[model samples]
Target: MSSTFDVMVVGLGAAGSSALYHLSKTGKKVCGIDQFVPPHAQGSSHGQSRIIRQAYHEDPLYVPFIKRAYELWEEIEKESGKQLFLKTGGLMLGNSNAGVIKGAELSARTHDIPYTYLSNQEISTRFPAFKPDNDVVGVLEENAGILFPEDCIKTHLEVAALNGAEILKNVKVTTIHTHSDVVTVGTNQGKYLANKVIIATGPWISEFIPELNLPLTVERQVLYWFKTNEPSIRLDNLPIYIWEYAPGKMFYGFPDLGDGIKVAHHHAGEPTSPDTLNRNISPEEISSMKNVISTYFNLNVEFNYGTVCMYTNTPDERFIIDYHPQHKNMIIASPCSGHGFKFASVTGKLLSQLALDEKPELDISLFSISRFSK
Candidate 1:
């Protein structure tokens, strides 16, 4: 009916699994619970591949987190003996003065990261598969690549188990109440008690902490995989790319990894709730994407298939990695605003540190909840 743990992770998707793994390393009694078995398509961490790049176009503040994330990824890959990341390089493309280009360049320069500024002709010459306009430019970072998200989550949970963390799958947490000394996590199965709790529940977080009234929205994003057999568009010649087609509008693509060429718009998605998100991909949606992406890629390919995901977006699209304002023993982590999978590994370790009352080695002051205080 009830069990106690040092730490209880309520959502074992991206950051929660990693937190469990890291916490398990400390030999503490840690447990992770997920409503659905993770690596499943029901949530944001389920896509086949996710992009990981050092030159963060969103902001340079993310560079240090990414730098540590890469190291943690390799560390886990070796521990799990599974190839989680693939090196295919990355390209941030947009007009010469667009946010995609300027932000990427600024991060690269600020962090002293290795990057190459490519003009329109240079981009076309280097990556011939792409169709860049005369004014389109790019910032190429060799360290950019792909991460097997499902495999990463699986590996994290497996390794965490091997390290002695209890993984409770198919267990839906209904409520969390802070007692005098422990947090009571009421679940469909029963109840769980923990000295500290980490709620990385992605889109479902707002349901748990309504008092915060945190400005968060759940967006329904669709990913497309178009069937393309162009020999020029092979993985060896192509790099993971995010293009700002028109000023603020942007879409991203990956090389055909057998399934097809993966493409999706960054922030253009319908606002919806996790429980009520429409998973069906309509003909109009596919046609709309096809019409726009056709000008950039050889969209002579047919729409093989598409899948849906959710993005728990903050007002500024940054991440929240701090303690709950009311409950000091509870840490809240909502890292998805379209881009979060890549940082799962490091975020896990940070959560472990916070739960254990240890100062995080890396500065997480940027993600504090106080910023939203008015």
Candidate 2:
């Protein structure tokens, strides 16, 4: 029918929800729609917990954004009155020179963050659950911890709506056409038009931005929650841990949170589309991850459960946070390569600035879509 909203955000996940909140704060007419009710298990934002640390092991460029993200997360907590984050400290274990370990050390040094590098003997003495080899060491950033992922998304959406943003859940957008003045979006429910359009769809990004033909591969990852022998050894007592079994091959686990000791491999999975993501976790799959955890912790073997989730990865593993080259009014933000959760709050704020043609204070050149050009 007619048009509404100054901005129409396509997905209400980490990035989109932040955009909605910031835009609404500016008193702009804004609306956000998601394929499913966000904070639901259907998207990457689910799961009970996600890791949040300022010692970015990925790259030094990410340190600034991550630092800002930490601040924004606290701001969101104060505004929403939700205990969405916990600081139980975090451990990064790997070979002294390994990318994961060294990267974190470098970020900590570059940012002047408080961190300590411990040798294998030190690790065993301090954290008994770990058994790193002689050559392996760890960078312990005491501030790193966990974020209640689903609750974070919900808080952002709720605050956005409280500030006068419109949100529609369970309605999928089918098509989008942009003009010089406004953007028109067609969905299963109806049609919407707005002065600006942002497509933050996680796994479904390529479907809308076909021209980019982005090589985004969707892979299925399984999460297993193991029961601990002692309830005290669970989430409350133990800190969050990530270990690099080998370069680019890693396994991470969280403390027991009544659900069990959640463990999962990072970046090792078979390709699949979101619509066809395998929901069933095979017996062999559980065995494989269980074996990895057994090496570090004593598994009760009696109490644990597992579930499947999807990861949308780009070749370089960085995110695509740029807008359409032709349609500058449209922005795309699908950074679901696994580590996007902690940055969701800041990304939302930056994307909102981008929607209004304001440059984000942090450098997003690395995340630009043009980096994919030949």
Candidate 3:
């Protein structure tokens, strides 16, 4: 195999695959390497479905990126000729004064996005699956929906390969050497050199560049699917819902998509390293999730099965999408803080532009690594 390329991307998950695809379109020799075959159950992108919403409660700065991401997803769907997104609408539920509710409302209003604030009675009347307390309300956005994560990743890889981007799967990158001009990436298989390198290896990022001491944490998240006794829990009626059950705690769920309703806590997971992560979901965890479901939703559901995934998180729960402070040729693009798969499409474009030494279309100043220096 040729050991030289214009760009080499480590980690063929969401961001890497998209980067490879966009980079390939630039007619540059680009290659993507992944430790495991993507669309697999191991990473943050593998669940059956992921929620995509415009009203980002985490921060309003994400609205523009997500807006462009929606467009990119549509383009990918048209190019791939596959069903990648499903518009089931979305609901953010919490007390009227809760941070999530207030933040989501703020983003919606600030962006001029179409949304409706519904009272608890209105929520019950419109969405029978929800049973929020009198103090709880919701912000409903019709454009919000679910994205098929595995399918999205697979489509990006397939399209990238079709565009002449090399994909090296099951290859773990051990060390990355950045010289004055080119960057050399060392993997278990062999070494490859590139003019630019993107490190999108998700949880394994710290393993390769410990010198940065990036303050990144890997959290072990559990996803549960439940079989509901009521048919109203199906997708046709139920929308993707996120509830801030407590002040700072959250649990989100999807409508029944044939198999079962998928539910999981956003960030409250066990801190672990990628190499030493425990993939098993304990019964106690299931019971805990069940307790939350029973309290918020009207559906009587039984646990079907659960899967474990990892979230590469930053301290403030924002993404880190800046180039290495010292090595400009080495771009670091992991640690999405759990809610990043939705932005993969636009992120890929941004990373590609950055690698090509071009200006990014969106303002990514909020994701710069220098913020942590202070």
Candidate 4:
């Protein structure tokens, strides 16, 4: 009483959905399953917008990956016949000695990526939306912009379905068991079998293979939207920006897309499981964020609302996107830490290749799970 396929993708969010979409083109019997209807608010992919930039501050190795991702996103955007990406440029703001600015510069210079180094006065002159301190400097990258998260996911799923991939929604996967030839996925409805399975489950991945004790930590992150009367805060005029206020402390914000300008502190939340995360934004949290905003920007922002998402992070913050060590038939990706949505387009293609026993065009040696052991 079950169906079978050549490949199965568990967790149809950023990575899984893309993988399913790519695999569907291989003429293989591929299928994807999700706990809830995707483009839903239950996971990490649902903020109205996510920043996509080329100046890789986290690591320069990510630059090439993002370069390929940009091309793929444009290709999909064209096929979907909808506006999925907005070219708003991007800014990295911090003092001369700040890690955020220095790292971004290092990446830009190393990769020959086009970027401009700006003084605080230059930043104020170019973008009137912010109040940069005298010593604060900036890195301006032209191609960096915003991606509509919900639209991107929906487009991938829609295109994949039209290409003959089966999508199962509202079905919770209870267990995943892999043997010699087939990987069995047991869901609330029934068991499904596949030759190989890509575990792109995002935050809830640990629930599948708890015995591995993978070093992944699920951090509860909040994205806040604020309304400002400042006319210059519109998306067309303002670029997405990351503000490194102190040595390593930072927060990022988006240009107002009519709804409001969005802001959130980077890596500044408590560790929590996906199921037990507190969903509401408290007054205390809002006040703390307001204090940060008031210190960094000149405009008065009224807090609109906050939404919660989880980051499945590794110890070093790099992603784990390789085959399961013990099980060759299983491929696993812990995620690209907190900054992976932009890479979803290219990552999906890589995952599809891995599932089909082909070499990925991009070198993913750095994201191997084995790195965690040493």
Candidate 5:
């Protein structure tokens, strides 16, 4: 294998694949390395589905970036000849004053994104699968839906490879050294040199840049699919929904698509590490999730199966997509909390721009690493 390239992207998951694809389009000598084959179940992008919504509950600043992300997803779908996004609409359900509901409404209003406010009774009438409390309201947006994360990552890598980008899989990167004008990345397989490097290694990001002391925590999250025989719980009737059952706690779910209805908590997972994570789903965890489903939704609560994934989170739970503080040629772009998969399409483009010294189209100051120093 060649030992040099224009740019090297580490971590071939959501962001890394996308970055490689966009970088390849620049006609530069780009290469991507991954410890394991992508589109696999070991990382954050393997779940069958991930929600993509325009109403930014985390912050309204994300609205513009996600708007562009929607466009890019469509472009990739058209180019790759694969269905990437499913627009089933989405609902944010909680107390009217709750952060989830209020924050979603604020983003919609600030960005002029079309949305409908529904009362508890209205929600039950429109979507019979849901049974929110009298005080819980919903912010319904037509543009919200689900994205097949594994397919998206695979398609990105495929398209990049076809465009002449070399993708090295099952190759663990051992160390990275940045000189005055070049960066050297050492992998178990061999050493490769590049003009720049992008670190989007998800939970394993801190391992490569330990000096940053980034406030990143990897949380063990469990995703469950419950068997449902009800017709109302099917895709045609139930829109993807995020419910805030309590302050700072959330449960998001997708309608049945033959396999079953997929559900998981937004956060509130046990702290863990990538090297030593418990992949098993315990009965107590299953019962805990069933309790939430039975109380809020009108569907069968029988847990069919469960799987575990990791969420690399920062203190603010936003994202980290800035250059290394000391090494300008090295970019850090991982630990997206849990809400980043939806933005991977556009995030990749932004990272490519940063890697190539082009201006990013969106204001990403909120994701800067300097915030942690303050």
Candidate 6:
């Protein structure tokens, strides 16, 4: 039997949902599947909040793409009538010369983003919860804030379904192969074919595209939500903050959004495969975090909840977004280096264009898969 769709999306998270939504708008037949429905804790999109900032601290090349992502996220909100983003201004706090702080300042200056500089004293006066050391400085970027991650993924997938896309959840894609001009995907229930394929699987990217193993390692990360005794220091009054306690050490947290004040370390994680990653937090890890967080927020932090997420990282911490070198009809997109959530909306647009053989408005040289060739 012959089976086909205009596009077959292998993962239903942010990237796949966005691509399905955009493809559906064109009245094309797009089919999407996921091992588990997203907004579920099974994948990378379950966290309650993700930071969205205009300042491109990672690299100046990211500024434009992020700007477009912000715009598209707003557009999606307007179209869907859903509250997908919350504006909690962001602060980059650390030594002025630190890569996190300096890179943000440089990006803001390069892109002309609205920002403010603050000394340790100024930060304390404005936000009593934060008590940076005397030498620490802060870069306040007005455009930075948080995105309601779960809502964004759910809304996009719902919109995609409303526009003619078919989504199958709780189904596993076991195998995929290409022949002649079509690609065949075998799932738990059945098989389907498509002219084009998009593999946006987060940590599982390597499992499906082993040829480009490209040194993608999955790291086990933990998210902690703490309840604050002072309501004034909670979500509404406090701004999102990213702090570097010392060289090469970073932690970021969001204000209490009813649940509690959510905080997590940026990169201190044990390398593990997604399937075998341990979900439980260790006492040692909690003790270490308590020490760091107590330095900033008042010690009255209440340990409320915790969850585990996976970070698919590359050597340089950049993303891998491009077509399979050997397969013209297959596209690969796994930007899960812990900072990819914010760019998911815009990335979906670009991935859709690439699958359709159309040019994206922005340059993608910086994110090309070829960067790993060396």
lDDT of 1 by residue, 97-205 (tens): 9998999999999999999999888988888778888889899999999999999999999999999888999999999998768999999989889999999999999
Order of candidates by lDDT, top first? 5, 1, 3, 4, 6, 2
TM-score of every candidate relative to the true structure: 0.98, 0.97, 0.98, 0.98, 0.98, 0.97
Tens-digit lDDT track for model 4 on 92-210?
99989888788899999999999999988999888887889899999999999999999888989999999999999999999999999989999999999999999999999999878
Between prediction 3 and prediction 4, which has the larger lDDT? Answer: 3
Assess each prediction's global lDDT (C-alpha) against the native: 0.91, 0.84, 0.90, 0.89, 0.92, 0.85
After superposition, the stretches of candidate 1 with alpha carbons farther than 4 Å from their true spots are: none
| TM-score between candidate 5 and the true structure | 0.98
Model 3 compared with the native: what TM-score?
0.98
Instruction: Give the clash total for candidate 1.
Output: 0
Q: How good is model 2 by TM-score?
A: 0.97
* Candidate 2: segments with Cα more than 4 A from true spot: none
Better of 1 and 5 by lDDT: 5
**Residue-wise lDDT of candidate 2 within 228-256, one digit each (tens)?**
57644555556787888788778887887
Q: Which residue runs does candidate 4 get wrong by more than 4 Å?
A: none
Counting clashing residue pairs in each candidate, in order, gives 0, 3, 0, 0, 0, 0
Backbone clash pairs for candidate 5 read none
Identify the runs in model 3 with alpha carbons over 4 angstroms from their true place. Answer: 1-3
Report how far off residue 15 is in candidate 2 (Å): 1.8
Residue 231 in model 6: shift from native, Å? 3.0
lDDT of 3: 0.90
- Candidate 4: residue 203 lDDT (0-100): 92
State the TM-score for model 6: 0.97
Error of 4 at 113 (Å): 1.1
Residues 1-374 of candidate 6 have per-residue lDDT tens digits of 23689788999887888877777777888888899977688777777899988877788788998999999899889989998888888989898888778888889999999999999899888778887888889998877888888889888889989998889899899987877699999888889899989999998888888876577889989998877678656766678888987887889988878887889999899998877989998877777777777877754776777899998898888887788888978988887788998998888888888888889778877777888886
